[model samples]
Target: MRSSGDTRSNSLRNIGLIVRREYKNRVTQRSYIITTILFVLFSLVASCVPTVIQFFAARSNSQSHITIVNNAGTTADLSGDRLLQYFNSNLNGSTSNGAQIPGQQASQSKGTPHFALRVDTSTPISQLQKDVKDGKLDVLLVLDRTANKDVRFTYYTASASLSDTDLTQIQTTAGQLSVLDKSSRLGLSPTQTQNLLAPPVFNVVYTQKGSGNDSLISLAGGYFLGVIGTVLIFMAVYLYGMWVAGGVADEKGNRIMEILVNAATPFQLLWGKIIGIGAAGLTQMVCLVGAGIIGLLLQGPLSAVLQTGGTLFNLSYIHTSTTLLLLLLVYFILGFLLYSTLFAALGALVKRQDEVQNAVGPLTALCMVGYMASFIGGSVAPGATWFKIMSFVPFWTPTMMMMRVATNTVSSWEIALSIGILLVSIVICAWISARIYRIGILMYGQKPGLRQIVRLLRQ
Candidate 1:
């Protein structure tokens, strides 16, 4: 019993040494440092995109010039000057006619005016159309009185892709002008017209448990978390899995594996390298996540500093629970382990660094399938039956389960079950990988096929 305990202790020490060597060697590399810094900078820049766009939009000098040509022969109570004044006043956050236009609120009209209006009753329709087409005018409005006691309007613009805001503003202004014209003809007071056109107050109530403000916040937060989590896991697994495979192949090519095997068992060497490389990856990820969190936390203050009321990153939108965060960490670790172990074994099968990629192709494809499934399942149908089924799958559980959890579409029991299955799968993978590594690391000449691997494992 004492000898067995000592043997176990020695084995652990060897594994720890390998882990330390792996972690230190990777973290100290210039390439690793540069890559991590670049990723962090990229994330920071991405988070500031909305703010940058808002700044440019606020500074843009493009303005829409609107010309109204009234072809109506009869005298109408509507004044084109009055309409222009109302539009400018509405754009400037005030009522020009001492009454609020329907759907035009002061709070909604806070942006800089992108429209300039002019009234020209004498300009020919052909001239106006030519002006619009020649880029001299942004929009041309032709108005005529109909026999049915209604006004007919024809609008012309140079391009179809003009700003929707400008179009909506024009439509709203025209509708209000039509209403005011009819009201004036009917001898209605301005106060009566304002009261008649006032919109009714509408309130919305959600009946579902996860449909409240908090729930909506949670959902949004979950979406961001899910997206970030999926991307990070996919990258970590892919990048570091290749690292493990490449490291193994390099050591094999250099005959370093023979020396390492003399010092420790194949299982110890395999696990030691995986854990070590995994720790390096984990360190890089932690730094990135930490940088992202700091950037998110500072987004509000940054927005304030820029005097842009709109924030690029809204932390309030991500309401991830403690349990969900813990689950994510767990899934990340297990998912890495699952992929890295397979990578290490595949690395043992190859004699040269060039063969590492080819050997790991099958595993890489599997990871991609899981990654795609997580995205499609989460975005297309989070609560779908197949999505739930895929979440329970070991290879897919890390991403798919996290997505469902983030969306609040998964139950605790289901999460626990998925995690349990994943743990079992990891154990199985470890055993199989260890067997493959023991045999593959010593083989030379021609690379063995799957059938040979199976036959060897059986032996």
Candidate 2:
């Protein structure tokens, strides 16, 4: 019998060899090479989508010139310049495709304005309407008062969509103007009118302390990153685990397992196959991630060169940290090991490659359950009690925990506990898989029943 030290060394050496072989084989395949290249390109392009859109938007935007026609002397109280400033404030705060630039005012205090505002009390109503119809004016606002002395606004646009932001802005401004006019007519002092128009002071208190006041974009980015992380984890596990099963089945069908078993222990073969294929998947994943990062870095330079002002597709909103990425790698490795071991064992039970899928059906279903649960929980509520509990489950831990991590909802202790459970679960799965693999690889006829497999394990 070999010494335990020698056996340990031999196992490690064999696992290393297997891992390298498997990785090389998978990566060297024409399909695998093409697929990896395509995915890398796709990820890079996808990351720059927001930047491309912003570039086009900056170029394509035609400043909508609005000419207001006041028939009832609505500007009698407020000067035309003040009215124009108010309208510009309401409209140019930001544009549809543009992100809000910090420290930039809507008045073009430092940046370009989106809307041009001017009043034309001198122009005849007929001429103004004609100008609007002729597309000389993007919008025409006709203002008057009703029998109740309330300001009446008539909005005209030749090509205004039902969901135009300008329409909403005009309506909001009209209401404010009507209030101001009424307040002025009440014979109130300027201070009283200003006080009446000012919003009431209201303070907000949080019941639960969060990760500070993240912007809407940041909050959305966190959610987006979480969903993407979960998806990547799921695909790597499911797709590569199938590769493990298919490979094992193919080897058994060709009677290569007999030769391989003689060269190495069943345990070594089992782990070697898992590690080998996992390395290949990891390589592809790394390329994809690196490409995405490269694309993100390129956005600023691209924006400058194209003169799109700046990258609106900023990833700064997503809280990507080294800890998060490391955790992602940890969970992926553990999750892949936990599932692929079972896939390997199941593959050994099959008589042929085609039978592998049928043999692994139950495991596939269980994996699907966890995948669907993670996606649903990630989208709906990543911090709910049920989601938290589910994250601790070995099957769902990787994806669900990452969702929590990305959203900054899970505590450090929880992450530790989840990873601990997953590691323990992987060891347990490997043990059971090793047992099944010892006997199953040699069996060439009909698959053994649960009772027979149990008896085999007992022996």
Candidate 3:
């Protein structure tokens, strides 16, 4: 009888050969290279979409040109020139060409000032109205007093479809103007008006403390990265898992699987193919990660070149920490290994490449549960009881746990527990898949019934 050591050595040798064959065949394909490149390009483009749109939106001059006619005349106990300065200071907040003017409060609205207010007392109201109608002026502001001597502003715009932003902003300025005028009539001094109109100090502070590398991650960026990380894991599992099933189905359809099975035991073949495809998938993932890093590094220059001033979408929220990265890699591998074995087994059961999608539909659905749940759970409550429970489930552990990790909400024990469960689940899955694959590869005809599948597992 052959020694157990010799049998073990032979199995290792056979597995090594199959692994090399499968990996080389997968990575060397033109389809594989093209798909990887396309996915990288698509990822970069998708990530930059918000920045690109902001650039286009900013290209247009959003400034409102308002020609003002101050007919009420020194109602606030100030000269026309002083009223002009007040309007300018309040509306634009003393910014020149997007640069902050010293000794001036920055505009309440983001970016450059919204309204460029200029006195046009010399010009006839008819001419100003005509200018507004002809689009030569953005708006015409006719300032007058009501019957009660209260300040009133009548404005005309070129288009009725324009946003209410200008109207609302001007109303704020006008309201402030009325306040000053009223304060003056109440015998209040300029210092008291200044004190009364001053805005109170307000700021946001996060009370939660970060643990270890969590402090290195951005608050908003952590959530954003969680989203990105989850996406990367989901795509890797879904795409690469399908590839594994399709590869096996293709081999079976071409009759190469019979030769492969004869050369190696089904258990060895199962591991070899899973590991091989996993290696190839890992290669693709590395490229994706590199591309993601490069894309993130380029965002600063991208924002500068686009002149977006980093408003709306802030990439700073994402801080890629070494710990988060290592955890992602670990979870990514475990996730793929766990799913790909099942995909490979399903591939063995399918007789044609065309049937692969249908055969693996259930696995896809299962994978999607975690995939979609991570998005909702991560956004809603990464530390919720339900989320924690789901994260421990082997099928979802890769995705949901990573979300927890990215959010910096998970403990070391939780990580260990989830990983431990995943490793165990993978072992059980691989053994079951090996048996199914051994039988399914040789069974070339009608689909096996549920009872036969159960019997094969029992044996």
Candidate 4:
């Protein structure tokens, strides 16, 4: 008989061979390559969506054609000449009254008129309405004077939603004109009227300490990290766990497990498959993350070209401390191993590939529950007592702890304690799953009941 040391070495060699075989077989598949490339491209495109929108918005001609119908006649305080001039000035990126609006910066394309204004005294109101309906005119303004010496303005448009900026400009112009007319009657100087209309400056200061005094950019970055990390972990666990289950079921259904068991123990097969698949998944994730980083790096230059200022993909806000990164990596690996091992054991109990889904349904439900809880807790109450307690539970720790870390609410001691609990749970799960996997892989034909599995595990 071979020495125990030689046997252990041979077992390790066999496990390595299996891992290499599994990894190579999956990675070389056309589906894997195509899917990876497509997913990476999709991530890159998604990050640049804001820049694309800004590019189109900048290039498009945004001018609105407006026609004015002045029914106030010559006796009214509202002059058609002044109204037309005001509209033109405001639409052409200037304030009414022949003055540049303070603090108003021109758009990338300088002097692009936002509205084209024309006074149409000869066109009938009916014709103007038809023009608006036919898209020949964007807006029609009808000006009249009330008996109380107040000017009345009415607007008609074919569009369902009128531009707020356009409406605000018209309102401000009318109000200024009315004020000027009254100020002239009261013999007030232009300077006094200007002072009366100018907006007042308001300043604010924060004095509270540790009151979540983070900037909006930093908070947004933290939220993005939490959400993206949660989604990535969830997808990796669920998708790769199902793959492990389906792969095991496929091999068993074809009676290939009998041959494989002779070459290596069931425990070796289980871990080899999990590690190999996990590595493959990690490879895909690394590619996706790399693509995202590249996209973020390109965003500044792209924003300059597209004139979008800046977008949420700004990397300056994301905190990349070594401690946080290490914690994320550890949590993800432990979480993957925990779920994938359970799936492998369940896969062994199934007699056919079709039964894999039924065998893993409970496990999938458990994962979904943890995922939903983490999302709700993180978004609704990150610092709630219940959320803190759930973060210590093995099943929920991966998601919940990652969320807390992303939000900067988790302490180092708390992380250590949660990880300790998770490690213990993983060890226990590995032992139980190995027992079940060794016996279940040999059974076939009829699906084994819970009692039968328990009895087999005892043996």
Best by lDDT: 3
Which stretch of 10 consecutive residues in model 4 shows the poorest summed lDDT? 100-109
Q: What is the C-alpha lDDT profile of model 3 across 337-425, one tens digit per residue?
A: 99999998899988899998988888999999999999988888887889989999999998899898877778888888999999999
Task: Report the number of backbone clashes for model 4.
Answer: 0
TM-score: model 2 vs. ground truth:
0.86
Worst 10 residues of 2 by lDDT: 95-104
Cα lDDT tens digits, model 2, 416-446, are 8998899899998888889999999999988
Query: What is the C-alpha local distance difference test score of each model?
Result: 0.81, 0.80, 0.81, 0.78
Worst 10 residues of 3 by lDDT: 94-103
The 10 consecutive residues of candidate 1 with the worst lDDT sum are: 205-214
- Of 1 and 4, the candidate ahead on TM-score is 1
Show model 1 residue runs off by greater than 4 Å: 58-61, 69-82, 89-111, 118-134, 160-165, 176-221, 295-312
The parts of candidate 2 lying over 4 Å away from their true place are: 74-76, 79-82, 85-90, 93-106, 109-113, 116-118, 130-136, 186-221, 310-315
Instruction: Kindly report which residue pairs in candidate 3 clash with one another.
Output: 221-317, 221-318
In candidate 3, which residue ranges exceed 4 Å CA deviation?
1-9, 75-79, 93-116, 147-149, 183-217, 303-316
Clashing pairs in 1: 221-318
